[model samples]
Target: MGQREIRACWFGAGVLVGAMAASLCAMRAMARARADVSADLSPEVSPEVSPAALPVEDAARAPSAAPESGADMFEYRGFVVHLFWQALAPARYKAWCDIWEAGAVVQEAGGPPATYPTAAEARMAGGAWARHWIQNNG
Candidate 1:
């Protein structure tokens, strides 16, 4: 091909490389957040940063104070489901979606707020946060 075509090919390659790098960086950050959330699962852990207790969107923007209902807790990839707490008063609490490749939570929604036993499990349940439960106590 001509020099112009060669230059265009290089430019396209550069863009692809850049996108891949960005994706990787995002995945690493998600993994870190997941780790941080798991590591500090103590009474001292601040409620402000906890995923389970996320505050509703700005009140000024909304008309009512009522909590959102039937909202999915998490969403990642194409999976979506509700999470329920089988052993507690508020059986259904929050939801979360797993960005499986990123090793982190892609999204999360309302629930009673409990640290997940495993990151993998939590991620898998993304888009199904309202159905969270202690699958195994071990």
Candidate 2:
């Protein structure tokens, strides 16, 4: 095989490995989350946390999706950053981010060519990418 072909083979293999690793991590995280949720909702729950004792806001508020593992909101200095994955063909994902300052989106970063095998991997890498951008540009 020529040099370019060999390089492409290695790159493809690396992507596969990365995706598999991310899938395993995501599965583990999901399992742990399910266990925790089940424990909280168990029939033997404590009195203070019973369903009837839960509080609701007097005013309606817009609902927001809970951040996934590895994509939770993080802050540095005065900026807030959150990572996400952009789906690409053939089950690949690209890392992306929304960076906020003063309660508004200040930047959006990353995407294309499906650099990651899973959303978890994308988010993890995206977080680093965002931090790097913040360090140099923010």
Candidate 3:
């Protein structure tokens, strides 16, 4: 191949590598943020929580916290999605929140409000939802 062709090929390769690196970095950041949510969910789902705050007894329950104030809050800071079994009598549900930084929670409560499912499931769903927000927004 000629020198010109070789240089062009090298340039293209560089661009591809740069893009891949950026994507990997973003993925790492997102993973870290999701991890924060998981960590925060731990204390929020304990059995000794206030009954007034939780309002539910089953591990499958979801949170009843209201939505975030700003649209940007949901887009940037993340959100809380209440996953209920049914509309009227949601016995057990899951609460999913998305945090921004590695340990930054998007909720006013500093974590997801309250979840009804086992701590594992609540954390899983919350992390999944947070990752979804990051992926979709970016």
Q: What's the C-alpha lDDT at position 98 in model 2?
A: 74
On TM-score, the candidate that comes out on top is: 2
The candidate with the higher TM-score, 1 or 3, is 1
Worst 10-residue lDDT window for candidate 2 reads: 58-67
How does residue 52 of candidate 2 score in lDDT? Answer: 45
Residues 36-61 of candidate 1: C-alpha lDDT, one tens digit per residue: 44454555444355344444443222
Model 3 residue runs over 4 Å out of place are 42-138
- Between candidates 2 and 3, the lDDT winner: 2
Q: Quantify all predictions' global Cα lDDT against the true fold.
A: 0.39, 0.61, 0.44
Deviation of model 3 at 126, angstroms: 30
- lDDT at position 9, candidate 3: 88
lDDT of each residue in 1-138, candidate 3, tens digit only: 999999888877875885596567546645654554345454557535533666455333332232211111233343333221111122344444434443233332223455544434454455555556556653
| TM-score (all chains, Cα) for each model | 0.33, 0.42, 0.32
Count of clashes, each model:
30, 0, 9
lDDT of 2 at 29: 58
Q: Candidate 3's error at 87, in angstroms?
A: 38
